[model samples]
Target: MSNTPSLTANLRSDLPAALVVFFVALPLCLGIALASGAPAFSGLIAGIIGGIVVGALSGSQIGVSGPAAGLAAIVLTAIGSLGFENFLVAVVLGGLIQVGFGLLRAGVIGYYFPSSVIKGMLTGIGLIIILKQIPHFLGYDADYEGDQSFWQVDGENTFTEIINALGNPSVGATTVGFIALGILLLWSNVLSNKGKIFTLIQGPLVAVAAGILYYVLTQGNPTWGVAPEHLVRVPVPKSFDDFLGQFTFPNFGAITNPTIWVTAFTIALVASLETLLCVEATDKLDPAQRVTPTNRELIAQGSGNILSGLIGGLPITQVIVRSSANIQSGGKTKMAAIIHGVFLLLSVIAVPTLLNKIPLAVLAAVLLIVGYKLANPATVSAIYRSGWKQFGPYIVTVLAIVFTDLLTGIALGLVVAIIIILYKSYQNSHFLHRVDSDDAAGRHHVQMQLAEEVTFFNKAAILRELDGLPEGAILELDVRKTRYLDYDIVEILENFATKARDRGIDIEIIAVGKRVMNPPSYMKFFDLAPAVEGH
Candidate 1:
């Protein structure tokens, strides 16, 4: 059977998935835009391009693209540091660099990230989603919806914001939050299994429709009415020209600036990593377990961002949040993603007023569910059981991301992974054994076989073995399994050879019968001869 299914084969499934994703993505786009310090419509632009442009170009069957919450902090800082127009230039430049990465096959870098770290990233982002959304969930939305940073622009940290949310809650917002949350939980647990009709209507969409109704009905009661500030705010163009005028053009003249290039490279690097990571994660969430061609995904993302930047949109990436929602909603093909994009574009133009009626609290409740799925305690326990080598990086990554930012947390995890590798190399560099033979010679044999690859890090262990040998013994230095021996170890062997006679020890060195690799320059610089002798 063919791996790729016909796009129209699953329209029954894809259509509902598309509607569900459309509802899920709408608030996220607006929220990420607000968080990034960009005009809210810019996020919709990115989301639209992500769904139509990237989704159409990508080979991923279930993965969805959008303005990522992970990039919000970067977008916010870049806009402030470079000015909005200059930052748009950086975004464009970043898109070109991403295209280069795709061409160069830099997508393979994603494979190098440890599984523990990747899990940590997902879990970390999940926690960030939960923590950052608490205020909005409670209706005191002083901060933007998708602001994932530890220290917010409002000068309140994640903890302080939570405390404040508890102190001052909005009755309308709080009421909508619980009601929406209840509706989601009920739909997911009970109603979703009822029939086709229930499945077709997504919990999020239903919750949103209910919230909008609640908002309209509560208008007469001031205390329980959701304020305009707590509702979705997509710009409604006065006319066609006004709609076109919303997009801000990049300042191409700023391309020559060094700061612009630096910002571009940073955005390119970070966005690419985030995209690749999400690709891996979304594949796991796929029911069919279909794989995404990551390099092609990079190209699609590059193209989308280029278009998005030209028309004033936040940078786009394959976002796990929306992609997961799409998958969980039973999205079958790229068509679902494309349809969601079309909906986004049409909604702002045709029914911005209807979307504006959605209370932010309802969206927060929806995200809270998604956040919980990402950071499930079961997932954390499974990671812990994978042993310290995996857990160390995983836990550190989670903590770092929770306390700091996404990039910093991953950096710390990578460092821990390297440390684990080095420690294992140091401990497992060689095999040591003792042999007592009842031969005519009556010789006691001590054998030490070198690991497949030995470097300077193993020198101390080799030296300690050599120094502790008995006064009269046969020491077998086995290099038969060694692929490459370091110069430092060679020098140690040579020095020991000179002292072995005085200590009444006879040493025999063994190397592979196959041809030996010539020593590196470092060996020659040390003037140490190879201790290997072919059988």
Candidate 2:
């Protein structure tokens, strides 16, 4: 399939998807901003830059970018340790490093990510979203927004928080969360399927609208009145100047701060890794199976973070939550992603007050649906059915990510994948079979056929096979299918050939390049034993 696209070709599909993404992204942006311990407007700024700048420059058709929940902990720590103004300088510096990474062709690293690990990453994030949102759904509001790490900013872990939330649940928030969840389920299954009118009217939008209406109606009631802390808290600017004043500028003087530079480098490395992983996952999720240019994606992300930092925004990355929503909503091109950004800009500029009126529990319900789709039981079972080669890494990645950070989880999964590859290589380096030709020489023919590739790892296996060869045997060492043979393996075969002659073994080398020999002079050159010497 062609990688390029016409803007208008997917307009119908893209437009509806963009609306859905906007509705999904709005709360996340505000929530992530609140989580980062930064001004609320900063999250919106990042959302805008990610959508408009990255969405425009990126080669990914459906992947969406925004201030990510994954980066919330890092941002929070960075701001607290480096000071908010200095952290802004770090974000800008991190963006510059990402750009350099793109130029260095580091994007090629994305291709090496294992597919099972990618799926596990998606599944792991989904499980984390679900786990992290439970307290919010119950309106506990103890931990700040966008806190997904197992060890929360609060002293409690995820399970402990859930237990605590159950002990002290809010009646109003629970009611809103349940009602919103119902509306989301209904819209996804019934009304949204009825016709075009309902398709464009997304489930989350309706859920948010319903929650806001409920909040207003129940304001004075004793049983259902929602607490102020449980509600969303967007900065309600009094005028245009007040809105502009909310934007914080980076302090260029922080350039000399070594901690800022270290934080910047850390952010750049982690952000780049997350972006590459998401890009890989999103491409897999795409129905058309289009490949994204990983290098261009880094450039887009770099540009977005640079602009976002200048305007006092949180760090941005390619977010799977919004991207998966776009795909599920039938987005066919990058236009949907860009249009969602446009909505984020217009919403803050035009209706920040109305947006602020929405309840956090409602957004939690929407995210719960996304989480369920990602970590469905069927997906887990299917991966298991693929066998341990896939399931081991898949489960390990999920567990690691759920327990640790995204990069660590992926790294563990990759290590497992590499181990499996090495094990398989060691297991299947060659095939040894015995055949007898009747009425010929009345001799047994033992054929050793080489595998497609051989490396130093296969030396022991080949040596064992050679040592097991029977005396006076008619042996055939075949290398016809071998594409790669390590020097150690060649030396083993050459040394074995010398011993075979003494043992009265008829060894016929087949398809091996050049006569393999243990040259005494060559061995002396490296101060090693000659290949022809007996062990």
Candidate 3:
């Protein structure tokens, strides 16, 4: 088991990683809100809560939590149906429900998920990222700006949106986007290998800087300059008072609404699942392959959601986008997570105006790269190599996620994976009987071959056969070939052996090592009998 290290080492590893996470998180915060039809500030609040509150409470060193794209569609529908004020009440209640889940110890579900499905999920998500970011890269904003669905935003569906964006392109935005893309590609592929300058400066950072410079050069011009429509337009609060004025409070009065309760439960369940999945996936990506504590993560997420809801912010979870960025950026501890939160808080206060200057196109370019990496072909190839048992579930999960919404797709994949597991278990639990008879009394012998390993999954099959044993039968359990047997099966066998002795049935064991049957001195009378050869 891995132990949590000292605070000093954590700080040293986390600080720099947090900086990278901050950069990755900023746009996502804004984009998710835009997609969900919520106030852009809501996303920022969620990010802050996810980092400060969730980060502090979570057991994961590398998992970064924040507003998730997966929840955007749900949030959008809930707000529209329940009204924004009432929806917020549900969000608060949702956090409370998540706390309940932690208390119930429901976090272990993550462990049962098939490895194939999980791999497929990661690869599918990566592909979606690449596809969704294309319009933004081309300066063609077809969808509601931050949509993550496979279908397009022009009310035409995903495929149509791609076509429409291609049909109509904004030259100025496209040019800036292409330039940014070129710079990113060069920095990642070529520049990083050459010198210290390349090593120190990331491609995304350079693309953003170049974009801002381009905007500045074309500041006064009408045709060449980046337009306001193409820029990231955060609410510009003029002063500290104005900024404070932007904060919205939840409608505590709506707490009694049944609709509020339903939405709350929905948010809590969906958010918790997403967080668990992301934590699992992020851990796999970690160079160290560290396992995060799922229960602790639930507690942290619940706390963050509570804070976010209280502040009239969006619900949050362990977001893979920022978490992956943290890993890639060489983050080593939770300090990076805390620092990223601080950066979010400071940026809104100290450099709100500067942030406002960044073109949405530039951010789009950054996301395009992030998305491509998530859904890359290399990931698919890797999954395929892990064997069909893993690949089958993985592919199913990927397709489900892509064709439908995230939660629905995951549920489908999980069910399929579970069925496969049960089928394999049943196939492994077979008993073969070979009988030889030559006398007038019709004497016969039976031999049962235990599986290579027996587990609880095979208990039913073994039990059914043992319960139906015939009278005057000679039973021989062959353990010479069995390497390991689960304690559950062993206990059952012991009981059956006692019953067989009572029934006057002949029972014998083969190759039973001394280590197999060391009864307690108190129960010496019931001590295990020795094995017989060819009984």
Candidate 4:
């Protein structure tokens, strides 16, 4: 195993990456909070805590933490039921519960999830990103931005929301959004080819800058300019003291509320699952293929959430949006994560007015591009070529997310994946046993025949026959017709071989080939010999 990189070197490499992450995280922080029915300032608080606290404690090198869209539905419901102030209490408690989970080392739960389910989750989330962002891209503010559920707020569901948004479009916002998107695409392709300037400035930054400049030029003209409704409104804190005063304390009195407890538990469970899933996905994207410590990540997330909630912020987690951006930006350490947090804090305090100048339409364009990258056609094609087992779950997950909400869609996809795994297990093989009585000397003969492929799934039946065999009986294992055997099954056979010898039973392994019988002692019977003459 390679030793952990030095902290000084890690920090140096992460600073520049963190600057990139800050740009990515800023709009998402505000957008998610706006979508979750929480105060926009609260989202900034969560981002700051996630970066400064979570990033400091996290074991993951590249995963950036912040308020997630996955928790939007839950937060909206919790606030409606418990009231915003009371909900803050639940958020704080949820962070505490997450801390407890980390101390208990519950992060291993992430590893138990099947690969199919995980892939489904990624695809589902990608589709959700695309679906939820479409309204924003079109400049329709009917629903809160970042709402991923198929259902919309106007009493209409997902389908209705689309219809309504299409019927009543904000032409000004739409035009600006498209213009910004065009600029981004052009910048990514043409401008990037020019030199160092394009290399240093990303497409998103360019889009945002152009949108701000456009807004500045058209500020006096109502018809041509972007409206206040379509712009990002960051809370303006007059002074350093005023900025510090924006932080709210959790209402600890709500601790006794049963609803609060339920909300806390829900946040803990969902956030942990999301974090683990993101961690796994991040590892796959890592060029070095390093595995993060899942348990440690939970602890870091827990601490970050605690700080966020204590300061009257939303729940926090390892958000894939920022993490993907971090990786794509060449972030190599946790320092990038910490720096992003610092930028969030500074932007809100020192430059809140400048940030507000950036039009929402431009931000929408940035998100649309991000969503497109996530749900790219190439990704879908790659998943399809991996086979139905992979593609089936992937497609189901995407559809579910597009049709429903994040958690529900993931659950449904997971159920489908489990069913597929079980079906594959059943198709692998059958087990059979035979016993015959010989007239001469009253001897008995026992035989066990395995199908072409025997896996760990059939261990119970094999073990039962081996244990039930009578002493002094002649035992025979017929593998001549078997084509493949799982390694786990072979180990069981090897153990049984040792026990049978001690029991004085006559044991024979039929059709052992010179090459096949040479299996390592740990996996003696797992070998597949060439087919012998006759059945």
The numbered model that scores best in TM-score is 1
TM-scores, one per candidate:
0.91, 0.90, 0.80, 0.79
Give the range of the ten consecutive residues with the poorest summed lDDT in model 1: 514-523
Per-residue lDDT of 323-368 in model 2, one digit per residue for the tens? Answer: 9989988899999999999988888888878877777898889888
What stretches of model 3 exceed 4 Å from their correct place? Answer: 1-16, 151-154, 219-225, 431-535
lDDT for each residue of candidate 4 in 1-535, tens digit (9 for 90 to 100): 8666655686644665677677667777887888888888888889999998998899888889999888988898998898888888888788888889888989998787667666666666666666666666666667666566777554666667766768876776777788888987897769878987776666666777888888888886767777777777789987878877887887888689898999999999999998988888777766667788998888888888878888889999998778877776667877888889998888887888998887777777766666666677888898899999888777877788778877777677788888787777665454445555574766568766667667677777678778888776777677766766777777787787788778766666666553332233524333334542111
* Model 2 TM-score on a 0 to 1 scale: 0.90
Cα displacement (Å) at residue 115, model 2: 1.1
Per-residue lDDT of 1-535 in model 1, one digit per residue for the tens? 8789788998888887888788778878988898899988889999999999999999899989989877888888899899988999988999999999999999888888888888898899889878877888889888877667688778998999999999999999999989999999999999989998888777888898899999999976889999888888889899999998888999998889999899888888889998998888787778898888889989999998899889899999998878877877778999999999999999999999888898889988878887888899999998889899999999999999899887788899989998998888878889889986634677678888888788888877778888988877887767666667776777777677667878888766555443222223323422333443211
What C-alpha lDDT values do all the predictions have?
Answer: 0.85, 0.84, 0.76, 0.76
Question: Which of 3 and 4 is ahead in lDDT?
Answer: 4
Clashes of 3: 9
State, as a TM-score between 0 and 1, how close model 1 is to the true structure.
0.91
Model 1 per-residue lDDT at 216: 92
Which residue pairs of candidate 2 clash? Answer: none
Q: How accurate is candidate 2 locally (lDDT)?
A: 0.84
Query: Which residue runs of candidate 2 sit more than 4 Å off their true CA positions?
Result: 1-5, 436-445, 471-474, 494-506, 512-535
Ranking by lDDT: 1, 2, 4, 3
The clash numbers for all candidates, in the given order, read: 0, 0, 9, 1
The parts of candidate 1 lying over 4 Å away from their true place are 436-444, 513-535
Which portions of model 4 miss their true places by more than 4 Å? 1-20, 239-241, 431-448, 451-535
Instruction: Give lDDT tens digits, candidate 3, residues 1-535.
Output: 7466654676645665576577668877888898888889999999888888788888888788889988998899998888777788888888888888988888887787666766767777766666666666666665655466765334665566667778876666777888888997888788878986775656777787888888888886766677767777667788889898777888888788888898899899899999888888888888877898888788788888888988878999998878887777667767677788988888888888888777767877777777677777787888789777777788888888777656666778888888788878876775668676723666456677776666778888888777776766777666656555666777787677777767665666654563322222212211342332211
Cα lDDT, model 2, residue 496? 78
